[model samples]
Target: MDATQHDADERFRGEVREWLEQNLTGRFAELRGRGGSGREHEDFEARLEWNRHMAAAGWTCVAWPVEHGGRGLSIAQQVIFHEEYARADAPARVNHLGEELLGPTLIAHGTAEQRARFLPPIVAVEELWCQGYSEPGAGSDLAAVSTRAQRVGDEWSITGQKVWTSLAQQADWCFVIARTEASSSRHRGLSYLLVPMDQPGVEVRPILQLTATSEFNEVFFDDARTDAALIVGGEGNGFKIAMATLGFERGVSTLAQQIAFRRELDAVIDSATRNGAIDDAVIRDRLVRARMTLEVIRQHALRTLGGEQGDGASVTKLLWSNWHRSLGELAMDVNGPASLLVGEEYALDDLQALFLFSRSDTIYGGSDEIQRNIIAERVLGLPREARP
Candidate 1:
């Protein structure tokens, strides 16, 4: 906020920009713009290598405290790093679920032993993580999760299914919220356990999407086990810890995501110009709206960073998800009739994949209806939605 702080922020931004420019070269040069939302399958090994490289360079968990194997970057510095990373077209991070979501949650609520054992692997990108929150019946309504975990001696054996798990096949661990108290219901009886995924008891089945990609999976835990001490917060307090993790989900990385969206929009604009779709007043107006909406999204994201994360997270999810879904539609319209066709075996082009994948934007993370309810109840002090 002060001039000295402003100068330091500029210097940090410069350092981030220089580092990306210098490192994103040679074999890594081709990896730019690879692996994101729908395109997570692209350059899988390459991106993993890149993530490890970042970890080695102390760029992986920039916001974590220095004692926790991080650079201890301030919020502004973290934003700058992410913005520069996106501006450089760096590969989508392979350890985002670990660094951004789980790491912060651990720092906030995990035991010191948990932090010591887990934070290092995450900082080094040695272990990847996937969230185990959604289930067949409880996607947005997290309180209804039925994945059960029973404590047996020094271990907790989990048994249930989780749907819509992103990158589960690639993840080494999953932070699961299971029903620990069978007699309790809703948000009351859940326990958050960190379960390993490499064991024989755990099964990950890829869920193929309309885009012909399988980034999401159905993960089934049949007596999958974790250490009894791996539970975050405490038993029956998982709902609180899970909510904290969700708050971290809407962190500084959203700024980088917006920059990537800007790149996508630029490509769409270039395509529309090449195809002379820009001549259509309607199409051109929509493109302009897309640009303006992206700016608004960035502003809202920045503003929300300084506020209460839970309430702001709902508004942030609503704003970006709907904007992105519309951007996908706009991409299709820009391509005109050619957007309908696919290559042999239904192979999708960038715009085609973008369009199809963005269809789930409003559905995943949190749905439009769910977000509105959160905004109404939590942000506006409204009555809770009546439950059945």
Candidate 2:
């Protein structure tokens, strides 16, 4: 960055820091105290309210284009905003799919009217969205999805069952990909559509996990109708369009998520310190590794915003997810059994929740194995394997 860039970035950071110091006290303090404190559902209403509050102040999607209800801050400003928010233990994000994935895809490929209709509500957190990509047979091999979309006059009637649909029960809308023309090659016949979940013939059933958390769901769409106008890109281009959406998901958004990791890192260090374990060689070695990993995250994700997203996004996602899991385990190793308690609001107990959540990181957004394949075939010119 040049002198002017440095000065302007610092000015924005200073402003954000001051505003947070002033208006970000009570709720943030409570969240910090609560840290991984309750049932995931218990935080839903409060999280939604906080999302709208931050959106109203242009703090929710601060990196979005100025035309799309954002501050149009430089990547550095956005990083500063995220770091401060994480340090303050700001409320958890509530509009993940909408603000992170769907809005950006619409901005890039949807018509002007589509952008006008969709992006604003996402940034405002007035609309919530879930993804309908993975199906009964298509988890990692997304192109193998057999869900059908039949065009009928001005509308496309969709019929499919999507499993592992996170937050689908709570989402007001979903971005679905189905086989528009099933006869062609597997990858050639797909198309993406934005469908409303509140309409008739749409059912969302919770899939409770071993942890007893209902974060995932099974969505059945029996003749769910979405207008042709809601299509994201041209027919038969859904696979390509879905790739673009995933790029946004794993690329620029990784920066904010890395900031979340930093917060967890601090919590670990704090616990280690209070236990007088900081002086131990073992704990200090882990702290050093954590700090170095943090720097790598900033350099690789936050600073690479100007480049084409490409397969590097997948690489970064896998890297961060693995790092998160490792950090959680490290916390437990340093802090002991007290760090593994469920819904524990007390210090050291939050690490338990963090560890539990880390197991899902490799699964969501695409698995680590899938990311490695992308990096190998797409970026490294490797040969493709045939499935039996």
Candidate 3:
């Protein structure tokens, strides 16, 4: 970047750091380092309040356009902001699905009316959202989603199930991909509908995880209804819109995610030192390799930030997910035999929770197999995988 941009980013960094330092006090002091990944159940209500507090200060959605009530930070400034936020150990945000994924998709493809209705609440953190892309049969293969939504007079009635929905219990709305055409199959005749989560027809059943938290859920839409106009990108275009949302999913926030990963690594290193695990040649070598791979992940992410979307996102997902899963394994090794035991009430310490939760890292957010297939077929120009 140019010197002028560098100066501006530094200034933005200072601003973020200062604001977080000043405000993360009093009632919010306990929220630091709470709520993320396996620990989403930690101080959730307090974190929600903290999120709204940041929104009121214009810190949320820093990369969104100024017209959308965001600060309109440049990509460099956004990177600076996230890095500083992570440095401050701010609590995990409760609005990521809305701000990072749905808001941008709406800005890009939603009608003006939809933008006016949705964008403001997202910026204000007044509403929360969950994604309804994965179903029992269609986790990575999104085109296989069977959730059906049919037009009923002035509204659409959705009837089907969505599994692995994040934060559904707290979400106010769901951006769902449902089959709108009865005869449509695979990637055709689908519509991306914004359905309210509070209706009688919508059911959210929490799916307990290895972390002993229910951050993920199975949401049943038994004729759940949304306005006819709530469909994004128009009818029969859900696949494209959903793919765009997935592309946004892997953007600048990844830098902050890596920062969190680094914190976990540091903790593991500390544990090894205290427990004499650092004396083991195998453990020490693994730790060094973990640190090296993390830097590689960071560099790759920075390199591909504003580049092409699909294949680049796939490569990134593969890199970090594998790295993180490996880090979790190393954490267990560092903890030695104690890692096998749970605390009172089956409670797990952070490292134990990390080990268990990170097992799913390669499985969720498009599995490693799906990512490799995307890279092979799309990036390498290989023949497409034969579909059943």
Candidate 4:
């Protein structure tokens, strides 16, 4: 807040802009949907390539300390990095689970050996991880996680199922939450494990999103084995561990995502203008609304990160989720039937793809209703709604 801090923040922002301007050129601009960004998305190979590029550039896990293969960034520097990434229209880093979730948890709680063994490879993009939360029966009720892991002397035997695991099939590892001691209790009996996701006794059943191709899946554990040393935190601390990680997830996820949304908004405006659809007053009004929403989302994100906490601005996530859905709908409406087309036509011409992905943003992280409940109860001091 002092003059030195202000100067450092400005210098960091300027450095980030310079770095992106230097490295993010050529086809990457096309990748970020610059020629057009909302409907355009990278394929799996392009995504992995982008992650490697960012990782090598020391930009993958920008929040980590330098010794752990991060850039040793200040919070302001982190914001600057994201802003410049957005400004350059870079693709979202595909190693989000590694760079965001696993790395932070390791920083907070992992042992020296665990830190040394697990984090750097992730930072370097050698490893990819997925969240093994959200079981078939446990969606927002995270405490009801029934994936069981039993102690077998030196090793642990895991059995149960996790549904809606993002990138589960392709991930090298998973940060899994399971019920370890059921003394027949739910929340009090859980534990977290870092498991090799591709091992035997693991089944990955692809779950289709609205677009059709599977982006997530149900992962089953039939006597899946993991080492006892893989236990994250002490036993029965899984809920606490997972919740603590969600705080980091909410803010960081919003930062990365808001940038994406603003890009989408800009893309929408440009697409509308280019297509001659901006002549419609409805389209103009909608663009105006989108601009206002983007501003609010950005301000809310800053406030949430600035320490005014309440379920850590789950509302921000929920708002953007809904806002994006509307954006997709607007794109379709503005473009008429042509929005149904999906391809690599430069920028984000994959309107069909954006429309599809938008449908699920509300479901991931947490659903809109659940976020609203959290905001009401925790932020507004409201009473719970009883279900029949």
Candidate 5:
């Protein structure tokens, strides 16, 4: 962008910074830095309130179109807002699936009526959402989804399971991909249906992790139904719509994620210094390398946000996932032998939680193996991987 645009963005950044500083006070001040990936269980009700506060202030969904209850921020402005939010240590947002992923997908692909129905709740933070994509068998191979949805008159009955569904128990709705056509396999015959979570046919069972937290859940649908008209992008086009959602998953918010990682890295460095681990040449070198890699990741994220996608999201997913997982390992190493021990009732420290949770970074959001295949085949013009 030109200098004039850059200056305007800087002004916008200052405005965002000022607003956060002014509003993130009193009750909201206590919520700063609470409720993140492994810590989603922290101050959740308060975070929900904070999220609604943002919605009321027109702070949520800043990048969405104005007609859709968003500020219609430019890319530069959106980046500025997120950067300021991270810098201020704002509470982690609870409605990301709606505001970021599902909202954009609807705007891009939904019919006029669908957008009118869904976008308002998302913008108002009145309804929460979860992705009904990964099943026990599906995981990263999205094409392998076996969730079945059959049309019955004006409604579609969906029956299947989704594992590792983030905040499934709390969501009022879920965007589900289920097989609507029989005698079809892989990516075909799939339909993206918006199913309600409050109905009798739906169930959620929290999955406790090594960290003793259950932010992820196993969601089951037993003849759960949504209106046939609720389908986004039409039947047999679920795969394409899902891919578009994944693209938004790796959008401008990545820059804010890196800022969070930087905070974690700084804490690890402080721990290393306190425990005399910094004196070791190996640990020190690794710390320096980590810092440099983070900068490179930030630069790549900025470029990807401004330019053509062109396999950028896959590359980014690989970079940050591996970098963050390594940071968790470094935290453990810095903590020395004390890291292995647990407090009363197996209570883990922050570093321990970081280490355990980071283990799944490579596994979720399209695994490292899947990302590499995309880069190889799509970016390099290599032959596609043979499917069994």
Candidate 6:
């Protein structure tokens, strides 16, 4: 970039850093580094308040168009914002599913009325959202979803179960992909419906995890309803809209995620040094390799940030998920036998929690197997796998 652009980015970075430094004190001071991934239950109400605090200052949805209540930040500025947010060890955002995923989908595919109704609440942090894509039979094979929604007069009546829904219990709405045509199968005749979660027919049951937390949930919709006009991109267009949302899912925040991973890696190294595990030649080698792989992940992410969502995204997913899971394993080895035990009432230390939660890294956000299939068939132009 030119010197002018560099100076501009530096100025934006200063603004983000200064704001975070000032706002992350007083009542929010104790929230640094709290609530993320496997630990979403940590002071959730406090984190929600912090998220709203950022929104009121116009810090949320930095990359969205200015007409949509965002700053319309350039990609570089967005990167700077996320980096500074992570540097400050900011609490995990409470509305990422809304701000990062659904909000963009609405802007891309929703009717103007839908965007008018939803975008403001998301920008204001007055509403939270959860994805409703995966189901009992449709984890990675998303097109195999059996959840069904039927048009009834002015509304759509939805009935089905969604599994592995993150923060469903806390969400005010869900962007659901359900089969809207009874005779349809696979990718056809599906619709993306924005269903409110507080209605009588919806139930959210938290699924406890190995981390002793319920970051994930099973949501049952017994004739849960949404307005007929709430369908995004029209009926029978859910697959395209859902895929776009998934592409957004793998977008800009990944840079911040890698920074968090780096923090975890640093903590592991510190533990190894204090416990003398660093003396082990094997442990030292693994630590070096982990750092190198992280750099690879970061470079690949930057290269593909604004590019097409081809195999680049899948390749990045495979590289980072495997590397992260490996880092967790290395953390366990560094901790030695201590990793095998838990605290009173089964409390887990940081490394132990990392290892346990990282086990699912390769499985969620589309599994490693599914990502490899996308690369093999879509990128390599290989023969399609046989499907029954």
lDDT of each: 0.92, 0.79, 0.93, 0.77, 0.92, 0.92
Model 6 Cα lDDT, one tens digit per residue, 1-388? 9999999999989889999989999989999999888989999999999999998899999889999999988888888888889989999999999999999889888899999999999999999999998888899888899999999999999999999999998999999999999999999998999999999999999998998889999999999999999999999999989888888888889899999999999999999999999999999999999999899999988888862364568888898899989989999999999889998999899999999999999998899999999899989999988886
In the range 212-271, model 1's lDDT, one tens digit per residue, is 899999999999999999999999999999988999999889999999899889989999
TM-scores for all candidates: the values are: 0.98, 0.89, 0.98, 0.88, 0.98, 0.98
Per-residue CA lDDT of model 3 for 1-388, tens digit only, reads: 8899888888878888889999999999989999999788899999999999988888888899999988888778888899999989999999999999999999999999999999999998999999999999999999898999999999999999999899999999999999999999999999999999999999999998988899999999998899999999999999999989989999999999999999999999999999999999999999999999999999998888862276689999999999999999999989988999997899899899889999999988899999999999989999999998
* Candidate 4's TM-score: 0.88
Could you tell me the lDDT of residue 289 within candidate 1? Answer: 90
| Native-referenced Cα lDDT, model 4 | 0.77
Please estimate how well model 3 matches the true structure, expressed as its whole-model Cα lDDT.
0.93
Between prediction 3 and prediction 4, the one with superior TM-score is 3
Q: Which runs in model 3 stand beyond 4 Å of their true positions?
A: none
Displacement of residue 149 (Cα, Å) in model 1 is 0.7
Over 182-267, each residue of candidate 2 has an lDDT whose tens digit, in order, gives: 59656889998999999997999998764556778999999999888888888989999899888777655566567777878888
Candidate 5 lDDT (Cα, 0 to 1): 0.92
Q: What digit string (tens of lDDT, one per residue) describes model 4 on residues 1-388?
A: 8999999889888887887887667756556642212222236667677678877877778778888878787766777777777767666667777877788888888888889999978988988888999987888778778888999988889999999887787789989999899574657988889898778889999876565557678999999988899988888898878876777676545675687777667777888999989999988999999889888988888766732233866877787889988998888887887775555632234566677678877877788888888888888889976752
Alpha-carbon shift of residue 93 in model 1 (angstroms): 0.7
> Which prediction has more favorable TM-score, 4 or 6?
6
Candidate with the larger lDDT of 3 and 6: 3
Report the Cα lDDT for residue 79, model 1: 89
Off by over 4 Å in 2: 26-42, 273-284, 337-348
Name model 4 segments beyond 4 Å from true.
Answer: 25-43, 274-277, 306-310, 337-349, 385-388
1-388 per-residue lDDT for model 5 (tens digits): 8999989888998889889999999999999999889899999999999999999999999999898999989988988898889999999999999988999999999999999999999999999999999999999999999989988999999999999999998899999989999778999999899999999999999999989999999999999989989999998999999988889999988889999999999999999999899999999999999999999999989888942254678999999999999999999899889999999998998889999999999998889998999899989989999999
